[model samples]
Target: MSRILAIDYGTKRTGIAVTDELQIIASGLTTVNTKDLLQFLKDYIKNESVELFLVGEPKQMDNSASESEVHILPFITTLEKVFPKIPIQRVDERFTSKMAFQTMIDSGLKKNQRKNKALIDEISATLILQSYLYSK
Candidate 1:
């Protein structure tokens, strides 16, 4: 079976994560500039077997769609246009960035390393994927 892919989309960067072919064990894949994401995915799908695309859905405390929609909707539209075959889903991303930062600190990441927003983004994507896996 093909693996599942997840994305944490940000204005500046986008994080990617993937599950194994057996659909177990989500892992952080990479973070790329938002502008480069489509091309990056095109290159990535060429080399990997991905069946599902999970995108982080940011929301406010009251469960309303946050201001992130301006960017996210466009990205989702682009994904649908570019990868029509893959099914896309959204997972709640509340507190993911905070969780990612806390996880890095708990894991003893150095201050310099923790400053890597790309790394944080990737971890957030991983967290989103893991959350979905756990829910299932």
Candidate 2:
């Protein structure tokens, strides 16, 4: 099977993750500037056989869509347009940031390393992808 790519969209930077070729294990890929995200995907897809785009869907405690959804919707539209063949799926992303931070601490990251927001984003994307994989 082709790889499945996960995206944790942010206004400043976007986190990326991908499954192995067997679609079994998900791993953190990289973080890219939001402005350069499309180009990054374009370049990535040229070399990788991505079958789907798994995107994080942010929600609030009330279960309503989060305000950040506004920013994400446009990016989703762009994804549909640019990668017309690859389908996109959304997974609930509530508390992923907190979870990522906790994972960093659990993994023995130092205070300085834990301060890296980009790393948090990448881990969040990995969590999203892993969640999807297990759900299947």
Question: Per-residue CA lDDT of candidate 2, range 1-136, in tens?
Answer: 7999999999999999999999999999999999999999999999999999999999999999999999999999999999999999999999889999999999999999999999999999999999999999
Clashing pairs in 2: none
- Model 1: per-residue Cα lDDT over 30-134, one tens digit each: 999999999999999999988999999999999999998888998899899999999999999999999999999999999999999999999999999999999
Tell me the TM-score of each prediction against the true structure: 0.98, 0.99
Find the candidate with the highest lDDT and give its number.
2
Candidate 2 local lDDT, residue 98:
96
Q: Which candidate should be chosen as best, given TM-score against the real structure?
A: 2
List ranges where model 1 is wrong by over 4 Å: none
Cα misplacement distance, residue 101 of candidate 2 (Å): 0.4
> Distance from true position, residue 77, model 2, in Å?
0.4
lDDT of 2 at 119: 98
- lDDT of candidate 2? 0.97
